[model samples]
Target: MTDAVLHPDSVRARKADVPVVLGADGAPVDWVKVFLGFGGMVVGQFMAMLDIQIVASSLTQIQSGIGATADEISWVQTIYLLAEVVVMPLTAYLTKMWGTRNFYVVAVIGFIITSVAVGLSSSVAMMIVFRALQGLFAGAMIPPVFATAMTVFPPERRITANVIVGLIVTLSSTIGPTLGGHLTDLLSWRWLFFINIPVGLLVIFLVGRYANFDKGDPSLSKGVDWWGLGLMTAFLLSMQFVLEEGNDEGWFDDGMILWLTVTAVLTGIAFIWRQLVYWQPIVSLAPFRDRNFSLGIVMTFVTGLSLFGGTFLMPIFLGQVRGFSSAEVGNTMLVSGLTMFLSAPIAGRIVRMMDLRISMILGFALAAWAIQLGARVTDEWGFWEFFTLQVARGLGTMVAMIAAQQMSVASLPVTMMKDASGLINLIRNVGGAIGLALLTTILSHQTAVHYMDIATAASTANAASTGLMDGLTQVMGARGAADPEGMAAKAMSAMIRREASVLSFGDAFAALALGCWVAMALAFFTRPVKVDTGRPQGGGH
Candidate 1:
């Protein structure tokens, strides 16, 4: 019942050559309890990651439910992301203060309370407030799982642990919209938040009972860096705001975006300076000193860019260009989710067999190739066309993710695992945010440019244009339209817009492919890390 009984001291070698993990009391601990505790935390993490995209599919329903305007409704997601980014890096500090079990359970409790509040909300303001709280709590649940995967399992079992973690992280995000759509259709948007209740309660029980990997250091509170915390919160929140809203608000042309960009830069610089100079920084920058960790963070960022960017783009294409409903879009996107699930075990095998860098490069190359295939996208493309693309993407994401996850933490001492985990996860989320912003900007600019070029070429002087116009006019006349010629012109203009949109999508896909290729090149720079087969020294409970 005590921490000593739940989480053993560390791994010890026996005369029989079997490695047994000992508890705080130096007694052998049950691996089953450790696995179950870690599993509970993983489930909690899945719930946190799932909320990021679940509401995306049913934003309209939620908007109406909360009586929000279209513009105001977007804040439902934006506020959550902003709050989450602010809290993610600070999780390491909190975990060290409260220990893994207490921090995780408290987070789940906070998440559950806010979920219920969000579901019961009657106004946009109330919903946003609760959503921000939910995100803050949910953010605390993510990093510890990554750290635990590396620390709790020995090197022999690390690959399998990484695979499960990688699969859950990617699969949950990939399937979020699909599940959200079905839930909304079967019930309502409120169910999205309501559904977290039972699952959260279960996580609480499991984690409370079995998560005893570490004990709280109450002494850490004395040196808490309040200044650094303030700087980081301001920096991350401002930066996230700029990334989330810059595209819609016309980037630097908008005053708010411009000011926020400046604020973000200044505070970000200050935060870095404070972290370097301050004795006890809120979030440690020590993880960057590890060559593998630094390189792994970069790869992790690219993985997030491709994963989130691809997820964002496909639904837009399906819904806008293909005229698919939310449920239909979800169904179509399931290809990528299923592929990710299937490829996880294979990814584990590949990571185990091949050099980590080689595995990472292969994954990035496959992702680039898949996105490059999407560059040939046409308005007529459907499920089958995207099916091939999704398969490659799913495989590439899983493999790259497992490699990146391992490389990020493998080189760090156990003492730094929590800090490293927080930083890596934060970078990935930031990468996703930046990717969405860049892709959205590209889609907008290219659409207008392509539309103008196409419109200019489709003039009356062109025989093809004239002939098509005439045919459309005749068809409209036969259909008894009053303004047949004018309607034909309008129809031609709409067609041009649709074509322009498709072309822009191709350009965006090309951009994502370029990102993947760049990441592939960067993978070569990472230093190789030794497989960790024994207990990490000096950091165990």
Candidate 2:
């Protein structure tokens, strides 16, 4: 019944070799230790998720403090994401070599140290360096928590544990912008990093003392695949650089972007080649061969697109068009985050009562509808108008995440659990990066197109344009302006541009809605998981 007997040589199987604190009659340990251990891992996962989005709204303030140019300030996020994606998929191998518990504890401590260092940084360069370091450690900490859900817990509890983990992953990113906005307004941008200290320390203390489920393997230390790692690092670094900077620098036009594109292509091929041939690959690619897992990865990708696309768009819309403050923007999103949290139990119940396929179909339908509704937004709309959209997104997120997660790894062999967790998370992050990039590119292109058309129409002698100009001129004349027509023209142009921006946002939302529909179609490809027998059944090892 133990993992050792089932998998024999799984890294998780090695966990059985560790000395466990026994309970009554040498029975399995109580839930207290499991809860403590799981709780600590969850905190670490929370910090990792929070750190990525925490800077979403605070970039402007941090830029001011560090005297960074706009381009340099954007790298604050790019570097962290780059580091995270680069390190994420390799967690399975690293944890195997270092031992899961030891690697996790060290990553927590390192993440905390880097957080303090980032807060103390005087220049943008220093901050970027420290944040990259923070991301490296944070990325390593995340996958293990999910792997723990599958490998460390008993079968009956795996579903519950996964839901809890899923909620943290979804909610942390959901609340990130809001939390960052408040801390920046109430204190300083540095407080964002400093806030992690106490939480990180607490997680460290608990994990260090109570986590005895996973043990390290010294044997994996031999024959470490440094070449595969080097190829992976190169590929991720180059690919992320291109994705993050391609739009600003002019996609294939910029020499740096062009060269990085070539580099990424080459390294990506090489990494895949290495993984296929290497005896000790840095990241296992075998999991993708499973049809269900492949569908699950695609679903997770769409999940990232929905979650990250919405998260990226709302604040920009509020800040630019409506002139809302960071605090206000965060406050609007806080409701959605709470909705996601409150809806987790309902999602959990759905997973237990309904088939994952049905639950996922319903989730995707709701999410697509929610995003489609945002395409109807107008410049005058406020928080109340966005309420339904937010609530629907929150509920949809909970259902989709819980279902996708359970479906992703439910059928993989126990030995492949670590690989499944790491690769699935890697896909999610990569999907988010791709989604944000795609949405931003669309917004920029659509805004320019809309602005040009609006400006062209206004320059003509159309009745609507002329009437608007005439009204503005009379209003300005009544206000005692000398050049009423000129002032009116300028004001009218501004109005046109603002409307164009709003329309551009609508286009972005529509695109995301289409993405959700695509996810819905993919949900049908997922074979039903029958759970009515009171025991979860997975595919063979």
Top candidate on lDDT is: 1
TM-score of each: 0.94, 0.90
lDDT of 1 by residue, 1-541 (tens): 2364232125565545445766666677667788889999999999999998899889989988878999999999999998889999988888888888999999999999999999999999999999999999988899889888877766667888888888887778777887898999999999999999999999999999988877888988998899999999999999999999999999999999999999999999999999999998889999999888888898899999998899889989999999998668877888888888988999988877767788889999999999999999999888999999999988998899888888788778878988998998899999999999999999999999999999999984978998999999999999999999999989999999999999999999999999999889988888776664333322112
Error of 2 at 249 (Å): 2.1
**Residue lDDT tens for model 2, 1-541:** 1212112122221144332333323444545766787799899999998997888878999999999999899888888889899889989987777766788999999999999999988999999999999999989889999988887665445678878987887778777877898899999999999999999999998888777665567888889889989999999999888888888887888999999999999999999999999998879998888877899999999988888888788878988999988678877877677788888888887776667787788888898999899999899766888889989987897798778888887667777888899998998888888898899899889999999999998889989988988999999999999899999988998998899999999999999999889888998887765442244433222
Which portions of model 2 show Cα errors greater than 4 Å?
A: 1-27, 174-178, 181-188, 478-483, 531-541
CA error at residue 134 for candidate 1, angstroms: 0.7
What ranges in model 1 sit over 4 Å off? 1-10, 14-19, 532-541
Query: What are the Cα lDDT values of the candidates?
Result: 0.88, 0.83
- The candidate scoring highest on TM-score is 1
Q: Residue 452 of model 2: what lDDT?
A: 97
Candidate 1 clash pair list: 8-22, 8-23, 9-22, 9-23
Q: Indicate the worst ten consecutive residues by lDDT in candidate 2.
A: 1-10
